[model samples]
Target: MKATTTSAIVLAGGLGTRLRSAVPDLPKPMAPVAGRPFLAHLLDRWIDQGITHFVLSVGYRHEVIRAYFGGTYGGATLDYAVEATPQGTGGGLLLAAQHLPADAPFLLLNGDTFFDVPLSQLTELAASQQTDWCFALFRTSEPGRYMGMEIAQDSRITNLRTGMEQPERLANGGVYIVHPRSLSGLAAQPDTPLSLENDLFPRLLAAGQRWFGLECPGAFIDIGIPQDFHRAASVLPVHTAQRTEDALHH
Candidate 1:
């Protein structure tokens, strides 16, 4: 059977401390890429993928994001979950996830990064595995920067941590398809700062929840640091154009 999830929750709340010099006074997702906000580009791709609804977890100068894209964009409905203080990625996702339907899975993406993944294909993989959640993984040399996860022979994720050693490590691509139940056991409350990489995911592993990591590759870049932020302007245009072309051909 096809998965019953139709929406995605985007983590758009972080304070871009590293990119503050180039993109001051704006949320990281609002950082301009090729004359448009980076989030807009992601949204465009999601819409092309047939996603019609989105929940944006917003904080740290969130009004800027709200002002730019109101309740809707490109025929996709938009909703917002505001955090009064820094609640980290896990807390923000848990809060935003409350807006999702209780029985279905919803997609999640990091606001400051882009990974050209086939959303529908990933969802299909999740259904075939019968897991509560699935994450996209990319082979990378710098596992220290992005969290590293070990993929088992059965395609289940076994371990995750920062600073994982050299070769054979797959970087977390910051994209997910999660059944709401997968997040229901989160150990933190809304007011607390919680990290998915540092806290929530480890607990899920300890609990033996069925989750898989998919080795996905394509135009991937994050503007979390100054160097990557500077590089995104050049890299994303190539990616965005290719995504558009693919959408048309499909």
Candidate 2:
């Protein structure tokens, strides 16, 4: 991998249905925070991580992101994969991957979420001879509201458990380093809706391929629902969602 390859694919296509009550007129990432669109801060985080290029996958009201950010963001080149229909996370990712280089591993971040983990570290892991997919794991008390994940002692993900009844578990941090070749199966067929947590990760895990998760302890938050959206509006101006653990049970 070249040191200059700081490209990333941002999954920004989600409709943000749950957040509509709070940001009814705009896309989730376009929601106002600190007098700017929430995505601006996210782009700042990625740009700070040495990412020089971005391929944003956008659907519902994508023009909002385009009109606001236009072609450049924080010194990084901005591009978009405008989805005419609503594709799930994985499909959106696949669409955006076409815009990235075939040989380089790309960082993936949820547009509506921010986790203060080092993006370079994830890419470092991905550059290894064996690493294919790498993810950041965050401990959350409200695992039910997010995707529950389990990583073994060797850092191999054993399972991504779902539902609200499970014990204290690490939630998917919505940050990843993914290789375009690693997702060939999903990329081959487009528009069929696939999810990173519910679909892609499972197939990767079952295949016994090389994938690992870094234990990233720092500010982590997803403005996916109204409760967290309100909480973020207050906390984001002064701090990123840094916590030892989130015990608030969403």
On lDDT, the candidate that comes out on top is 1
Q: How close is candidate 2 to the true structure, as a TM-score?
A: 0.88
Question: How do the residues 1-250 of candidate 2 rate in per-residue lDDT, one tens digit apiece?
Answer: 4444488888898999999998898999988776667787787776766888999999999987888777776678899998877778878888899898787777888999988887666666667634677888888776368777777887767777876456567878888887777877667245477887788778877887777888888787789888887777565535354221111211
Worst ten in a row by lDDT for model 2? 241-250
Q: lDDT value for candidate 2? A: 0.77
The TM-score values for the models, in the order shown, are: 0.91, 0.88
Put down candidate 1 lDDT per residue, 1-250, tens digits, no spaces: 5545569999999998888998887899989887678898888777778888999999999998887788877778899999988889998988898888988878999998888888877898888887787999888887478888878888888887678878667889999988788877563365679987887888788888888988887788888887887778777634335333223322
Q: What is the lDDT for 188 in model 1? A: 39
Roughly what TM-score does model 1 have, to 2 decimal places?
0.91
Lowest summed lDDT across 10 adjacent residues in model 1 is found at 241-250
